[model samples]
Target: MVLVTGGTGFLGSTLIKILVDQGTAVRAIKREHAVIPDALVSSSLVQWVDADITDYFALSAIFTDVTQVYHCAAKISYQPADHAAMLHVNIEGTKHMVNLCLEHAARLVHVSSIASLGVSKNGELITEDSKWDDGADNSKYAVSKYESEMEVWRAIMEGLDAVIVNPSVIMGVGSGSKGSGVIFNMVQKGLQIYPPGTVGIVDVEDVAQLMVMLMNKPEISGERYILNSENMSNKELLDRISKLLGKPSPTIEAKPFMLGIAWRAAKLVSLIKRERPSLTREAALAAASKLAYSNKKIVDATGYLFKPVDRTLEETSRLF
Candidate 1:
């Protein structure tokens, strides 16, 4: 039996659908009162359990008879106010999940983010061997994910079989203007300013497929793979989305100083409205930083090809 955490999330729900379609008996854990996605609501093969990963006793009860585990649950936030929750859910929760996997002797497939990986020192493509610099200008979310990954490594040292995948920005349809879909929605609404930075991107399907491939290959254990289809500037990505959505492309470039003002204004607006800010200081910095990731290791290991980013945007545009 296979168990999946964060089953209601975008990537987790997609992964569960694939697993169930493959005739796998899957059990998924979700937070109490979490709404199940429509895509996963009709799956008879999935047994849903409401449990929080941070609660060890409650989470451990659902691990019975589980042979494989996919750790897909994570909290993502760039706001300073969300630091505590992000650390609790991403780091402490992962520690508990790692401990449960160790006790159950279950093979683990951990879904990490490229945020945990290091920035390229020489402006080259970032690979698995890139050293994470804790002192560098890193986001709180990155710090949380990095520490969470350390927990998985600790478990590995104690004889738990596992593999990790660090995926770039995952994009897909049906996200309803949340997560990565926010970018698509911004373009559709004629966002005029584009950040002058580049980033790696991948399809959500590619990430899910790669996770399943890594889980089935025991010989590939004890290593982390970087999954990225292509690296492109934010302007290029937004331009593509605009064209696909039949909207005007972003012509104004948002420089660092401009972004600083924008983020501050957004924060003030959020405070008044009692809503999360769409732009945070950390997110603004990330948008202005150029980063690229290499998928050579995963490609060579599995000989798997990724869907082109433009094509993914084209397909996802229909959903808007």
Candidate 2:
């Protein structure tokens, strides 16, 4: 049996449907209050269970007869106020998952993020071998993901058969104005300012397919793959989305100082509204960073060809 955490999430739901179509029986966990996506409501092969990843007892009860696990549950927040909660859910929750996977001797496919990967000093492409410095000025989200991955590595050292995937800005349909999907919405609204950064993007289907492929391969244990299809500046990416969505492309570039003001203003607004800031200092900085990731390792390892960025955008825009 296959067990999937975060089955209600964007990537997790996509992965579950793929497994169900392949005639695999899947046991997917969700938080008690989490709403099931419309796509999974009719999937007969999936057994939905109410469970919290941070609670070991809740997870332990559901691990019976589970032979394969996909650890997709994670907390992704860029605001400073959410740091503690993010740490608890991302780090401690992963600790619990790792322990349970170890106890059950199940093969694991951990869905990490490119945020956990380190940036190159000389602007070279970041691969799996790039060294991560905990002391460096990192975002709250990056630190949490890196620590979570540490738990996976610790489990690996103790003889757990596991593989990790670091996916960059996952783009696809059904995200509904959240995460990278927000970009599509912004483009539709005639967004004018573009972030001065370059990002790696991948189709959601590609990431899910690769995870299943890696899970089936016993020879690929203890390896990490960066699942990025292409690298392009935020401006170009936005332009492509705009073209496909039949919206006006962003023409103005948002400079660093402008972003500084924007985040500060958003913080002030958040304090007044008692809500999380839409724009954060760390997020603003990340929007200005220029980083490149390499998919050579995964490509060579599996001889897998990824979907083109244009094709992914086109399909997702059609859905939008």
- Candidate number with greatest TM-score: 2
lDDT by candidate, in order shown: 0.91, 0.93
Worst ten in a row by lDDT for model 1? 172-181
List residue ranges in candidate 1 displaced over 4 A. Answer: 270-275
> What value of lDDT does candidate 2 attain over all alpha carbons?
0.93
Off by over 4 Å in 2: none
* Candidate 1 C-alpha lDDT tens digits along 1-320: 89999999989998998898889989999988998988778888989999888899998889899989999999998978889999999998999988988999999999889999967776888999999997899999999999999999999999989999999999986566789999887887779999998989999989999999999998988899999999999999998889888999999999999999999999999999999997899999899988999999999999998998888898899998
Candidate 2: residue 100 lDDT (0-100): 88
Per-residue lDDT value at 4 in model 1: 97
Put down candidate 2 lDDT per residue, 67-103, tens digits, no spaces: 9999999989888988999999999999998898899
Alpha-carbon shift of residue 82 in model 2 (angstroms): 1.3
TM-score of 1: 0.97
Q: Superposing all C-alpha atoms, what RMSD in Å does each candidate have to the true structure?
A: 1.2, 1.1
Cα shift from native, residue 62, model 1 (Å):
0.4
- lDDT accuracy of residue 63 in candidate 1: 89
